[model samples]
Every structure is written in structure tokens, then in C-alpha cells.
Target: GKTHLASALGYKACQEGIETRFWRVSDLVLELEKAWKENQLERFKKKFNRVQLIILDEMGYVPFNKNGSELLFQLISDWYETKSIIITSNLEFSSWNKVFIDPRLTSALVDRLIHHAHILTFTGESYRLKNALSKIE
Candidate 1:
């Protein structure tokens, strides 16, 4: 549901000619890993750096490995105060450590992310669940 809202915002940004990119957290991490292996990490980072808005969907849905965590932190750090990032997560601030598995990194990531961020929480049943129920009726 949150991903839907974030993607809608990304779509609107695209329509307005904003340089927006959308990526699922896991998929991004995989891409970054590949870039690192191919010795094009800097190029990959530069590509993301040029975007005005990035919508990172489904953070904390799966825990990241140490390498993935570091790459993600670097991405966040590089974009800090320069671009807008819309992150959709099912976990709260305190539980973020579980995903990163490193307290310090998690803290730093959270600090950079929430520094000038506006958080919007969605409550109630998920859209998928609502749709399934409606279909069954």
C-alpha cells in the first residue's frame, strides 16, 4: 500500500519532468553488488546521484547482508541533503537495526534519512488484503 502511494508520487514527478527513479530495495542492492563486481560502482553511484527523486520501495522487507548494508548506507549518505528519497518500510525506527544488523550504521542511516524527512504512516488493512476480501465476496 505504501509502495503504491510512493510509486504514484514518482509517476507524478515523472509527468512533471522531474528526474525520478524507483527501485525495490533488494533489486537495488543486487544491482549495486553487480556494479561493484564489474568495477563500475562509481559510475552506478553517479547515475543515482543525478536523480532528483528516488523512491525506494519495500525497505526492511528482507534483511541486508553486510556488503549490501554498507552499499545502501553509502547510497543514502551520498544523496543526503541533495535529493529527495521516499522509502516505504514495514518496520519502525527501533527495528531498523534488525535489518541492517549494525547499530552504528543503522543509526547513521536513520539520521541522514530523517534529518529533513516527512514521515507518513499508513494504518489499517493492506490494499491486497482488501482486494482479496472483496473478490471472495
Candidate 2:
């Protein structure tokens, strides 16, 4: 539902003709890794040059390799203060290091991401869990 709501915002931006990009965090990292291995990282990174907003979903859902961490750091740094980014993460900021391969990179990336960023934290029992319990009761 969170993702759906975020997606609606992205869709509404698209309706207004904003150049937007939506990506799953893991898949985005995989693509970056692929671009690096193919020696086309610059070209791949430039693909976002015309985009105004980027929605990165499901962060912390999987672990990132060193290269993925580096690539993501570089990308986020490039977008810092220049573009809009919305990230949905399952892990708290304090535990981001668990998903990233390098501690220093994680710190730098988190700093860049949180600069002038609006954070909305999800809390309490999961809706699915509540519904399931009610069904059995």
C-alpha cells in the first residue's frame, strides 16, 4: 500500500508531464552493476539526466555488493541538491549499514539522501498481520 501510494504520486507527476523514473532498489543496483561491468556506466548514469523525479522502492530488502554500493553512492551524489528522490526503505537509518557493503559509503550516502529530504516512517503492526488475526478470531 505504501508503494501503491507512492506510485500514484509518480503517476500524477507523469500526468503533468514531468520526466520521472520509478525503480526497485535491488533492480536499480543490479542495473548499475551491469553497466559498470559493461563499461557503460557513464552512459547509464546519464540516462537520468533528463529525469526530474526518481522513486526508489523497497530499499533494504536485499544486501548490496561493494560495486553496487559505490555506484549508488556516485549516482546519489550526482543528484544531490539537483533532483527529487523518494526512497522507501524497510530499514531504519541507523541500520542501513546492514544492507550496504561499506560502512563509510553507507554513511556518506545516507547523509546525501537525507539532506533536505522529507522522511515518513511507517510504524505499528502490519495491516496484513492485523487482518489475519482478525480472520482467525
TM-score of each: 0.93, 0.91
Error of 1 at 82 (Å): 0.7
RMSD over all Cα atoms, model 2: 1.6
**On residues 19-106, what C-alpha lDDT tens digit does candidate 1 reach at each position?**
9999999999999989988999998998876699999999999898999999999988988889999999999989999999999999
Tens digits of lDDT, candidate 2, 6-98 = 899899999999999999999999999999999999999889989999999988999997878888889989998898998887789889998
Count of clashes, each model: 0, 0
Tell me the lDDT of candidate 1. Answer: 0.92
C-alpha lDDT (0 to 100) for residue 116 of candidate 2: 88
| Model 1 TM-score (2 dp) | 0.93
The alpha-carbon RMSD values of the candidates against the true structure, listed in the order shown, are 1.5, 1.6
Candidate number achieving the greatest TM-score relative to the actual structure = 1
- Candidate 2: clashing residue pairs, number: 0
